[model samples]
Target: MTKPVRKRARETSGGQGRSRPEEPGEGGEEEAVTFIAEQVGALRKLAERHKLDVLHYLLGMTKLEADEHLRLRSKRKLS
Candidate 1:
């Protein structure tokens, strides 16, 4: 029979957040948002080239939101 897994004190303890552990160099949420911002910038350029005004505008907004998220996270860490 298979045994059930158990949680450790450090692994539990209410912990504020970060319940699920991540592998090294996998680049967590912040990295993901930064990557999204970079990609959105490139996509916005492509949309502009294709004369997609609405699409370009949407991508610009998306990039701004991602940037804002990073900014807010940084402020939280400072606090």
Candidate 2:
């Protein structure tokens, strides 16, 4: 004769049931943060690979503005 098996109360009575730990929600926030970080990193790498034209345009505009400021300063010195 063999002895029958006993299940713990924490386990579900249904067949083929899955059990989870008794606590607060799982670390879903951490997983979301990790996923967002990976996406941002991929975007940064893509930006680096494709060299944004807008950035170059902005830099050119800044240089032009600085040249105008210098020209005005020189004109004021001559007056």
Candidate 3:
């Protein structure tokens, strides 16, 4: 079996963990919402083309549950 990977300790400032720098010209949060909406539209079309039943099931999930499950599946695939 493969062993689990460990995360390194994080850096902190003023007793709280420091955050990574943001991207330059990352448009306002609304841009992020728009981008995600576009991606979902594309995914839906592709799912229909491929007849992906699992993708249909995932999309039917409540928003929070769908996102959490997709994130977990993506991490597993990457590993």
10 residues in a row with least lDDT, candidate 1: 10-19
Q: What is the lDDT of residue 21 in candidate 2?
A: 39
Clashing pairs in 1: none
Position 33, candidate 3: lDDT? 49
Kindly report which residue stretches of model 1 are placed more than 4 angstroms away from their true locations once superposed.
1-20
Question: Which candidate number has the best lDDT?
Answer: 1
Cα distance off (Å), candidate 3, residue 64: 9.3
Model 3 residue runs over 4 Å out of place are 1-9, 12-21, 60-79
Task: List lDDT for all candidates, in order.
Answer: 0.92, 0.56, 0.62
Which clashing pairs does model 3 show? none
For model 2, where is the 10-residue window of minimal lDDT? Answer: 26-35
lDDT of 2 at 37: 50
**Candidate 2 TM-score versus the reference:** 0.36
Task: Encode model 2's per-residue lDDT on 1-79: one tens digit a residue.
Answer: 9999997776465556444433575544334444555555555556556796565455445545555665676698799
* lDDT sort, best first: 1, 3, 2
In candidate 2, the residue pairs with backbone N, CA or C atoms under 3 Å apart (3 or more residues apart, or in different chains) clash, namely none
Candidate order, TM-score descending: 1, 3, 2
